[model samples]
Target: MNPWLPAAPCAPGTCAAHTGRTRLRPVAAALLLAGCAWVLAGALGAPFLPLFGPTRRERLIRRWSYGAVRAFGVRVRVTGAPVPPAGTPGTLVVANHISWLDIPLVAAVLPGRMLAKREIRQWPVLGPLAARGGTLFVDRDRLRALPATVRALAAAMRGGSRVVVFPEGTTWCGRGPGGRFGPAAFQAAIDADATVLPVRIGYRVTGHGAAAPAERHAPAGAAAFVGDDPLPASLWRVVRAAGLTAELHVLQPVPAGALPDRRALARRAQRAVASESANRSPESVHH
Candidate 1:
């Protein structure tokens, strides 16, 4: 009955009833853990910064991300292979941007420093966490900032750490392609001679351990942070929605060394994500 809740579920029989039930407890748990996580991250992370490496803070972040995803009551099923565990050198991860949840989802799956928009670094609790967790902030509005950002990212990649980047620049509804990826970040991998890992993020509805294909790769009633949708409103929608699932497909890695140019690398990563995204549409399935 919450105003933020979507209309009744579309599935037939008991599936509809099950889908209509909102999981408020998970949301509550997530909120509580989020508060604790941030507080601990700031309080504990700062003191140890001089002693332990960045991985300590990253580990804490990863734990919180896993908890947050569970709190959403959504199951994340990962397909394809992982891109060599956390320490592999010269690894650059790129994925399609969906909901703000994509942040935690990626953190939960691939623990690494994220290339986030400058705005995210200014958010409330997230700002502190991102700062402590080693996020690379970019001012998308400043053309002059691109080269420096690219150079910094290149240095980070070459230092033997995984860097996750959303090449789509901005978020989009999973119903279609997320637009062309900018070649600037790809230049980082090219410069560092890193392995480009293309990842596709999609949504689905699950019931009785089976998934129903989403409309435009987004499950019916799935949460999407697109357009002018406010963060609170999106969170409300997510908590109210039922049977939601996040599918993270780690597509094959493209070697940046073999690419002719940064443009070629960008196009290849975009194609991998876009093709996988299209594959999740209704037409891809057989009757």
Candidate 2:
């Protein structure tokens, strides 16, 4: 295994058990169709995204992202001020990785060029869409390519694009300690003198007011797509889940140069995201 590859202990058998109420098969099928159609629509329309100005493009991206998650039967509750608008001298949006749903959830609020693994560029439907949407792909297995990836990220940010990255380098179960934020992406922010916006994503299964002991821990895991879990299985689980709410906690933005180094910057953003663990109560407000 490459030393740079990040892994999480969370797995389908151990961490992705869905104990909450699930939707009927028919309902889940309908939701699955809608979600897939919405995603396809986005892919088909991606080529024209550059025709619109920044503000309008941002609006379209946000609206499409919202619809995508809603089609998957996931309700999103956003907190904190909206992300800094485009043309703000570039912003690096960092968040924890959980489910595949996290992609649309974050884009709904802060639509930007995503920093993704290079292997995604070869995936079936999402590959072309990601490329058209200007995703930055980094080859994680090649340790020597680190500097080039950082340069590309810096160039994108310098061009005034908000680049979204999951700096932990892998997905987690979102119940315990998330992996540490790698410092490579933070170096791009430092190089471009861009602001770092940290967002925390949490999920909870609703309609479980009086849940049993086994079902109590079903919130985050219901939507977790960690380890070697297949994509279709995770999607089916999400569509069938009852009243799954995805919470986006948009924490304060750390101003450019606030931290002296990439490690310091990574630590600051990680701390902001980790703070959301304290707000894990079920009755948290939504906006």
Candidate 3:
């Protein structure tokens, strides 16, 4: 088995559960179409992003990302300090992998090049878009390619690009224990001397009676895109779900040199995210 291609036990049949209430079929359909258009618009416009100044480019990426999420009828709630602007040292934005929405959610705040599996570069619409957006692809199936991928990541960061990565290597049911963070991505940060920013990505159902009292505001399984779950099925589940909210908790940033090795850094970052994931309680929705 390939070490980089770890299997997640979260299958769609068992993990992706939806609230009893959903939007009308017609409304959900419209939202899905709008969401696709918004995404395509961003992809088509990606080439022009480099023409703008860094500040303006960041602003455009944030706006487009937020708009894409809202277009799918999902509300976004972000907490914690804003990500530091792109600069010499750059940043490695790390997060838990839940659904396809994770990509845009991270970009909504910290717009940067993405570190994704090479397979994503061959995925239909998203593949082309990712390539056009300057995504760094890794051939996880080949152990020999690992060093090259790390070097590429370090180069991108040293060039002042904030790189986002989901070190879990697989998606999980957001409500339960997530996959472990692989230490490979941390190596790039160490090599580049970049800042490591751990962000927790979660989804919740909102509105009156949307969930049982105990489960209210808990992570929503409807948004999970785990093992063998078709992308279309996941997309439709999100659109039909009533009052879905995507939450991004940006934790404190740590310098790469603060830790002795990549494994230590990975464990520290993972612990921070796991703590936040476990401590979710009913809270007032602000939006």
Candidate 4:
């Protein structure tokens, strides 16, 4: 009935805290502090800090990103510890998308350039860092832009910089569907003749169970999903709550050259990621 607590809705902060949705305050505070902490660190890291050069800077950024998220109770579990061909030789890394949280989680945890959406580079606090971290973005609406974007992505790979792309295109709530991605990124990797490695990220719930009217705490996956809207209002609600520790598993690398073709590679990638995770389902990668 109220703006803050409207009728049932999917987006955060529109439903009552007990409506099996995010409680406003915790979510809001978490988002606020997360932003501030990330921004402040980068601001201090400075564009010319020398200490934050491409390699060092990226690692530093990911570490801080992981820490900020940990404070929010969203533990990131990365499986398939990077299988860099030739022992750290440059390769293109692809994975399925779980949430917007995936970007920071991977960026902060993995060392490489990320194939991200052009829009994220415009976000507050995170945008600048992404651009500097060498993240490549594709504007789906602008098809012509693909050629240039792909070229840049290839250059990074050839230059010995590991680039990560989420062929899934967008984020998921990590419960419904695994995710879907376009074939363009894959084609680009093929064109570059870069080996593709698949990675899986799973966030497990350590506390609580299914929903109950009087059970006002949290559900199974609550530790990772509750009140995370990247909005000031919702992040505030998660800060004080204790979140579960997430698990990460790194799978072996999948080479494009070993597959029959690009399509086959994509299909096998889906099966590989879905094959042996304890609880998560199969994941599909976009081209």
Clashes found in each candidate (C-alpha, N, C closer than 3 A): 0, 0, 0, 37
Please write out the lDDT profile of model 2 over residues 74-99, one tens digit for every residue: 98887665556556768999999988
lDDT of 4: 0.56
lDDT for each residue of candidate 3 in 105-215, tens digit (9 for 90 to 100): 888878889998888998877898889878999888899999998999999988888899999988998877688899988999999999999988888887776345445
Among all windows of ten consecutive residues in candidate 4, which has the lowest summed lDDT? Answer: 1-10
Write one digit per residue (lDDT tens) for candidate 4, span 67-138: 766656565555344434233655766766554556666655555778876777788767877676666777
RMSD of 3: 2.4
lDDT of 1: 0.70
TM-scores for every predicted model: 0.79, 0.93, 0.93, 0.72
lDDT tens digits, residue span 1-287, model 1: 22421222222222211234465766645754564565455545544554656666556666767666656566666666544665678889999877777887788777787999888887876677677777899877777788999999999998987899988776666655567788888999999999999888876665543334322243433456765556665665565666677777777888998889999889988998888443443322101
Candidate models: Cα lDDT each: 0.70, 0.86, 0.85, 0.56
Question: Which scores greater on lDDT, model 2 or model 4?
Answer: 2
lDDT (C-alpha) at residue 272 in model 3: 85
Against the true structure, candidate 4 reaches a TM-score of: 0.72
Q: Local error of candidate 2 at 94, Å?
A: 0.6
